[model samples]
Target: MNALIVAPIVLPAIVAALSVLARGRRQRVGAALSLAGCVGLLAIALALFAQASGGAVSVYTVGDWPAPFGIVLVLDRLSALMLLLNAGLALVVLVHALLTGVDRKGWHFHPLFQFLLTGLNGAFLTGDLFNLFVFFEVLLIASYGLMLHGQGAGRLKAGLQYVVINLVGSTLFLIGVGTLYGVTGTLNMADMGLRIAALPTGDRGLVQVGALLLTVVFALKAALLPLHLWLPRTYGGTSPVVAALFAIMTKVGVYAIIRTTTLIFGAQVTGPLMLPAAIASVVIGFVGVLAARGLREQAAFGVVGSTGTLLVAVALFEPRALAAGLYYLPHTTLTVALLFLVADLIARRRADHGDAITPGPRFASMGPIAVLYLLAGIALAGMPPLSGFIGKLLILKAALAHQAAPWIWAAILGTTLLAVIALARTGSTLFWKGRAGEMRHGAVSRLDLLPAVALVVLLGALTVGAGSVTGFMDAVAGQMFAPRGYIEAVLGQAAVR
Candidate 1:
């Protein structure tokens, strides 16, 4: 067992507990503690990422018990990447909150932030379904608090709806778990996969139903179309810092779908279910973005659309397509997260306009923000000379090999066009449209602005380093397509029947 394997989960848990106890004390203390936690997390993630990138799996069995019996934490390339991304995003979002006075909105904000990190890390590292549920609850609980961090009737209302929807998703998750356990007598994901694979034809009926139930729960989390109704309100209403952190939250569902389907259920059964939903999400996302009123709302809608496009890549189930999806995954996550903060920055300056499409005040930092917005818009719309273009190009190339190529191309390219149009309209409205007579300069915090800039820089880094990143994703896609190594790593070599 690698010592660093447990660090990802343990470090955050310890920080969360400390933050909880020191909750309402000195603001600086909380901030210092949270910063330390993120720094530590980033270190751990990099170490594990190096380890996993070598095609090695680090499994830490809890209480010295073996897998299929005791809890386990498994780190592979995909999960390691997710850990690194989450930690980096946490640090950036925390800095933004501190700079913008968002952490001051609630006493437990820092603690909840740490706890949210804990949940996210655990969900990626856990080797069992039940523990995944526990981690989901942990993060969701923290999210409920953070989602309502800033006091506002709008936030409160959105938070309540978010809570209620997740609560229902949780209930369905439990029922699905129960059904799966009754059939397989194990909660360990790898072991359950083995059992599902070896099951007789007649018994697969219930298992299929269970899988569908689980899919619905995950789909809701990923904000697939019909299930995505709550996102615009919840994500748009929250504080920008909170909304930025949440940029990766829906990906939890996407990750679950990718993991469960590819590793547990096999592509045959999962493909049929995921393909249609992915298509629906892309179409709905395009329509929603065009119809949205506020810039934040538009970004939120774009998230769903872009997510749908990524899932479409995944739904194809070919290694090439899946590899393309993996490449797009982090790119989409980072860009969407940055967009939320960008929206906040833009809104802060144009306070009177309130992120609406119409003209507004000439806020401070217009030049830098306009560039950031343009860069982000191009990436989000899959325009050229950026990581987004590369990701979409890869997906298109791979999808051409698929029988459903036409439909895939139509959905992704079509949405890309509509999204670009909507974004262009919004950009013109926000930056180029007629300005007020007297241009007022709003107070811009250097700290608040830095995080958004830093995020955009990272996206640029992705563009410059595309070759290396694409190679890494291709390897990850291969590993995902072949779950034999993962199963053997988790359940012991003998269990890889």
Candidate 2:
């Protein structure tokens, strides 16, 4: 058993508990400690990625019990990559929050933030289905506290809707879990994966229903269209820092979908059903993006659109396609974080000028900032030379190779068109046009610049190193499509079927 497998989950839990016990100035110290813990998690995740790259699986069984009887944590390429992304982003956001003095808003912020990390790490690491639910609840509860941090009627009302929708999703998740367990007689994902594949055709229908239900639950969390009514209101109404944190939150649901589909439901029977749902997500997401207005609302709709695109990538269910999905996941996460940060800066700048946004006479003023915004926006829209382009290319290649359903192409093309329109609109409104008033200079703190710079630099690095990154993604794609590696890591050779 690898000790590193559990560190990510435990470190954040301990930090959160400690933060809750601290007070006053000590709270900042607690926050620092939490940041340090996330740093440690990032280091561990990178190391695990290196280890997994050598074609080895790292497993940790909680309390020394065997798989299917005890909670298991497995580290494979996909999970390790996601762990690194999640921890890295959480660390960056925490530093941004601390530097910006957003931490001072409430004494509870540090503790809640830490708790959310704990849940995120736990969800990514856990090997049991039920444990996944528990970790999700941990994160959800923390998110509720974070969402409602500085009370206002607007925030409260929006948050209430968010909470209520998620609660329904959670209830459905429970039902899915119960049904799966009742059918398989176990909740450990690896064990269930083995057993589920062996069930007779008639009996497998229940498992399919359960899997679809779970997909719906995660889609709600990912804020896919039709189920995404609460995202804009909730995220737009929250504090900018919190909204940045949420940029990662929605991806967690995407992560769950990817993990569940590729790992637990990749059997022939279940894979087909998932394809249709993925197509629907893509179509709806694109439409939402086109229909949105305003900066925040547009970004919110972009979130839905991006989710759809990624889902389509996954639905393609080919090595190249899944690789593209994995690659795009972190890219989208980083881009969204940067976009939200930009929006926050824009809003702050507007507020400084007596709540009126007026651009200076120089059309090229703020060129550097505008470039950063354009790069991020274009990347989100899948323009050439960006990470999104590379990701989409891989998916397109895979879809053509596999001769996927006709609707797959239709959805992909429609989504691309809508994304173009949406991003074009954002560019024209946010960068091209100037408002009629004096330009006011708000205090652009280093805190604000830190996350923006970090995200932009990260995107640039990915773009420049696309070849090597795509190679790594290819390896991850191979491993994910063949579940033997993950299963063997979590459950020893004895459990391999």
Candidate 3:
């Protein structure tokens, strides 16, 4: 089972090379290969999840190298969950791309897609900070190409800003990694944790600076505010398929913050910093949502708001709140992805207005799409009968005991109300006040709608299985707070804490 940890990284790397080779001969061959790879990746993720569910940390060292000096991939509940989420999201987005012919816009889509998977899987599993930096580059490089996949002035412009921002982030990542290594004499995360805990009082402040630097980098990636201006334009301008896949990309940042704070710095250091930023993010993101001029822009801001909401629970640094945050994380990912797909469908049908929130002619199959829009809006706004509602309810309940409970409750509920009004207004204009003629520039078929509907159904399933899911999350949170098991698995000794 430990050996299987390498498969997620290896499979995608091999498939990406094959996809590049197959790209020239026939696009279908490449698509089919990429699809097979995603399916296989999903299977591997499920297998790993099953292994992780047993609550044992699994570590895979490269070429039999010893720890603190070797390349290692660690899988516990957190990494396994990220692997599964990315796999499932990749498969669904790939299907949508294939169905909508979005992949044909660029010859390298399949290869880049596979490479992005490689990067994501590597980042999630790597046990060393330096290797995490390497994977971050891998994913960002691929994202540059993917962001500009369907080239246009807007995409090209947004893609350039995206590249520059990430490059700066990569630089910060290296600086932090260098600082930490200089302080601790190692890049291995578990080893660093032990060393930091044992470090003399004098070096404590430097270590905190390094940790905060890394947190800023992660926050930038997660689109947390003051650093989130890149998300709306980048996501809004890109193709819906790319936008949908990129939804999971932000979670990578959130996941990094969660993993590093729990493992290396301990949440006490980063928690206070993350809390105020998170609240600000929620406020600014919802403001963006309400002020958006187009549906895709609205969806993009919705991503920001949802990330803020999830991080609110994470910022609490308490086990129960972390569990609630974990529950909300995936729900937001699914909900935001669903909104992107729905937005695309609505936009494509209306030739004149595209995705603008303004009223336009009745498009082909308007009624069904409107219904989907309503469902997606409900999910986004955390309305009842959806996983969003349950996730937020759990978060609010968990925060009730905190001193900041009032502020957290106010931020979440107030932002939710903002989302509701924005989506409601968009729906009213797009559906109810349409012009006379019915436009059918790109009429959506059942197949085109499948991915969005699938997301809604997945959310429904999450709702139905909330009890079991929350139980699992509780256990996952427990594993995170008690880091001894993770440290021992990697370092062969009990954690100092």
Q: Pick the candidate with the highest lDDT.
A: 3
Q: RMSD, model 3, all Cα superposed?
A: 1.3
Better of 1 and 2 by TM-score: 1
RMSD of 1: 1.4
Candidate 1's C-alpha runs over 4 A off are: 23-25
Each model's total of backbone clashes: 0, 0, 0
| Model 2 bad stretches (over 4 Å) | 267-277, 352-365, 402-410, 435-437
Give residue 123's error in model 1 in angstroms. Answer: 0.7
* Whole-model lDDT per candidate: 0.86, 0.77, 0.91
TM-score of each: 0.97, 0.92, 0.98
Over the stretch 97-152, how does candidate 3's per-residue lDDT look in tens digits? 89888899889999999999999999999999999999999999999999999899
Q: Give the per-residue lDDT of model 2 (tens digit) for 270-357.
A: 4665566667767776676666654565566667667777877776667888888778888888877777766665665555331122
TM-score winner between 1 and 3, please give it.
3
lDDT of 2 at 19: 82
**Best model per TM-score:** 3
lDDT of 3: 0.91
